[model samples]
Target: MKIDKDRFNNFIHSYTKDELFYRSLYNAEREHPETFSQYVDTLDRNFIEQHQLYVPSLHDSWFPYISENEFFQTYSQNIYIAKHNRYSPEYLHKHEFYEFFYVYSGTCINTIQGKKQTCRAGDLCIIPPETKHSIAVFDDSVIINVMIKSSTFHGTFFELFTNNNALSHFFSHTLYEKTENNYLLFHTQSDTVIRSLIEDIYIEYYGHKKYSDSLLDSYLMTFWVILLRHHENHLESFLNTTHQNLALPDILNYFQANFMDITLSSAAEHFGFSVPHFSKLVKDHTGKTFVQIIRNIRLEKACRALKTTNLSISSICEIIGYLNPEHFNRIFKETFHMTPSEYRKKHTNL
Candidate 1:
């Protein structure tokens, strides 16, 4: 398929919150005059212009009961895209497949099993089959729903995610290895690679002629590999996010935010757990002890600073919470197999 990539990107990026809300109001008014105000939570001009307070009927967006060939091309051509517009009916029902929703532009409120999650731009959500979920989206939200078949998700494809604990735990926890963890929300940080892959799929589907289906499968494989590559850097973050423990979120977030000075005793006290109890819990869940976790976080931060900043090695160590420059340098070299200066110089050239 021949696609004007520039024009497509321009059109995708064109809608902001204001434009989306105003356009929705215009459409709603045209479709059902004077009923738009009835759905508004607040009766004000600012609300009318900047936010879409109403939702359209769910009847129009109902799932189709049809064969794969009738739906698209072939049964093997399982992957496809669906759009979630605020004006369209909400697809609350579940099916026998996976739906990965990527918030491509703006933001939306995603409700999975009655729990609400505000997914901003660049966020990706993986919703499994038989899960009761719906998206209470707003104006300006471009939710790209990538549907993956269960049959195609196993064997060699599934092993890619299973190689790591965080993603492995997440996908497995959602796909019936465990319960209580329904879906995963990945903050992709507006990765251009992911955006490009989805756009390629969109273009190929719309302009399908000859070999687009096979090309789409190739794009999907590359897309998963890229996502895994980018996400491996934040394994602990993903673990903390997918953790089913109730107290872990606050403890993990606070620890990450204050990694410079946090200790096991202080963290235990703060979380209202005894030192030994807290230590055991952390180990059981994360497979790493408290000090090891903090040390890794600090070292990761120091590595980023080394590559991105022009700070002295001693200052870099201090910034990452090391009092002794020699100790920091020793560990840095041991962990990364290179000195800070050498690592920085090598990455800078690349």
Candidate 2:
């Protein structure tokens, strides 16, 4: 199952069946507007896949919200990667899985939450689950999509980017919360190492050797590490298509590192923002007040400890910033609808 480099290159260079059909259809619709309806009605049944046809609506064509179960089979692995369809103008649609879209070549229009971004070569966009987005490539362009199942994402990859840094904090929050309109972009067009690694990933995925699965995971891990290590300066985060959060990641990282003792005034001073402006920024970017964010971080740590460690509830509370046992118990029960001991027992048995 060894694929030569030249062969793999040729395979990707050739247009797929759906891509050719879409290109022809697009050309016909533009050139022969009067006969387009008749041409569409008389389309050759076998020219395109039945499930891949684009349906025109009263106002516009749309793609439906796709669920993970429908896209990934039960027996398949958690990760899926493929080349995006060329010449296809995908409409606004949400999916119940994470997608990493890498612009391999040329430029494509990426619309996220109704705002458009022209993604050029080597622009990597990380789209979280439940985010409404669309990608349109009218001309020659190549986009690689690396899709991860939502469950797998939470279980395995969640900790990969939780380090004490601005970029890591961005991923930690984006992945943990599954925010609707958040995405991370990396500009790595000049990085030859990442480009080669992506090619290797593609080869491993398509060649399908016996140990390709494990190798793919290693390659992906290396990919992430390389980006975090070498490409930190090239990173950007977007709350929506237009609004960029340049400093929010570092701010969130500061909060996470000092969740036990940080106060609003101290945080504002550290970030060099006035108290009210800092407070407003926190609310606007995170949709959570400072207290709420701290509580959430502490509670999250407590839940992890309850599930994995043999610590007593009091010790757990102390470690996660709770001073009073009664207060910890009340808050834990309020959040999980059960006492810490009960919650621990439930997760332990499962």
Candidate 3:
């Protein structure tokens, strides 16, 4: 079936009200009970509906320096960039699409979810879908952004990338690993090579040469592969030298249990290592610091609270283990740039 651009646009816009589409799908299924499975398939085939769910707005509480639609258009892969004057409570919010950010210039403290790290030029950060994050630009910063729809993977290639044990394991576990909360930045010693890759992709996407779509796809897939490979190599080297077996389940379980009381030292203690060693382990394994991991956990909790609960900002902060209202406000604003009250007011379903 041919992709309907208009329908796609409608689906994208309707994502903010996903219940309406799901209800319609349910009605359609009820009408065609015998083909209910087929009805669901039709949504995917007709509207690419499997991936149509909206990622909540990243900056609903703050004035966006860039338009969401315009940002999506520039990259042609659903990405955008913006410069901010102050620290945002979070870094980037994602839906089902994977997002990449390259710091072009300026110094910033980025808190992805909750952990804080500082970022400067040549630092690249990737956020997978459904993650909550925020950033505080210490100075005005230019960020190169890219977003890729998970469903964009199709056919045999999709299976190869999605179903492959190693790749799937990485995606399931460490794809969204934090670098730093405030700006735990990676220094790009070879800035030229990374910049070249970014420019090449951008040129192919915008230049629109013959077969550019296919070329862009190839470049994107290669880019992802290279990125994943880099992380995998780092993890391997870390494990081989440290002789520490950091399993995914252990890490996840640790977060789930200790997320409320999560601290850098606590995380280090959980793994039975010194704080510095634990910090290095996290950076090596996931390219993020201990603080970032904890913040990610907190931001996720905050997102869930914002989405589902009717808790007051103070209550929500308490629930998420942030006792200092001012600190929570600072962090929340850095990630989202909006006060929690403002975010809840805007996003709350009436």
Candidate 4:
């Protein structure tokens, strides 16, 4: 799908309805600080329903849980992108999806896990699921907020990072491990590729056509690989100082590719670690034993085949490292509360 450059620019630069209301409120507050509170109260009394983003007291004691259904709606295909409203106040909340904040211009304050940081132009902040965070663009700044379903990360986007490096390790632990409060920030100062990729994603999103979802996936993968290859020096991660040796990305990739025959000892040897150390590392990083990881990978692949392919259950079992159809059916029922045929039939209806 292609989009006109001029139209894309106009779409991005246009002020949203909420943004207009917040801009006017910001102007009033700046012009009259002494009576700004009273003015805000008057607005609250008359037009609060139209302008109030959230109740001021909502973030005082408890952070609201933002669910995927609230913002994704029924038309979404696992991704949502929008511009952060200018002059919006800090309303702290947590969501059950991955969020990316790209500072397109000016600056914005991003509070993650209770630590405030100012992100300038060319900075991309990635917040994982269940992380407490809020973005406040109190000035004339352009911040693009891109939200992706957590299932997408676990199923598709994360499969690109197969090499043993900081990038891969961070993602593996953040996605499958027991660690919490994790995020990544990349500072791509004046990188034309990064900027262009961001624009391409936004444009593809706004001008969605046939195969736009696949195109967005390609663009996002390219954007992320570019960051890993060129901007590693400018990367900031929550687990930067810890778990440097949890290089499980390559191992996880190996399992996914060779789940039919790969053994724990062979995998350990391929990665140049002893059997004991490899098992320990896998447990520490993924919170699952070696066999459990392999089983999970195999079962997950079986699910994909059931959803997207026309293969028979016995064939899928053999393809996913199972020799016996009876065992595969038993395990599949144990995990999904349904037999493989039932699962396939249910998804076919959907």
Which is the leading candidate under TM-score? 4
Q: Tens-digit lDDT track for model 1 on 1-350?
A: 25577677665555555546546555676787678666444445556434433333312344533333344334335577755655443445666667788888888887776667688888887776556677755465677788776434432144455353455555544443323326667778668988888887778766755655456667877887887778655322222134554444445556667788888998999889999999988876655688876887788677656655778888888887999989998888887688988877764322
* Rank list by lDDT: 4, 2, 1, 3
TM-score, one value per model: 0.51, 0.65, 0.38, 0.74
Mark the 10 consecutive residues where model 3 has the least summed lDDT: 234-243
Off by over 4 Å in 1: 13-76, 176-181, 233-350
Error of 4 at 55 (Å): 4.0
Error of 4 at 322 (Å): 6.4
- What lDDT would candidate 3 get against the real structure? 0.52
State the displacement of the C-alpha of residue 104, model 2, in Å, after optimal TM-score superposition.
1.0
Query: Using lDDT as the measure, which candidate wins?
Result: 4
Q: Candidate 3: misplaced stretches above 4 Å?
A: 1-94, 138-140, 153-168, 173-188, 228-350
Query: Which runs of model 2 end up more than 4 angstroms from their true locations?
Result: 1-3, 55-63, 240-350
- Per-residue lDDT of candidate 4, residues 1-350 (tens digit): 35576566566667877787778777777798788777666654345454446435232543478787665654446688778888766677888888888988888988887899999999998888777888888777799988987655655666787766666777777766766678999998778888778888888897756556667777888988998888988988885234665456767777777778999899999999999998888888777898987787788678767766789999999998899999889988997688999877765412
For candidate 2, lDDT tens digit of each residue in 1-350?
A: 45576566567657877888778778878899988888777766654446355635222545468788777754255578888888765678888888899888888999987899899998999888778888998887888888887555544444455556645655556644426788888999868788778888888877766656557767888898887788788878875332354455567667767877789999999999999999987877666788887887788778667765788888988888888989989988997688989877765422
Distance from true location, Cα of 41 in model 3, Å:
51
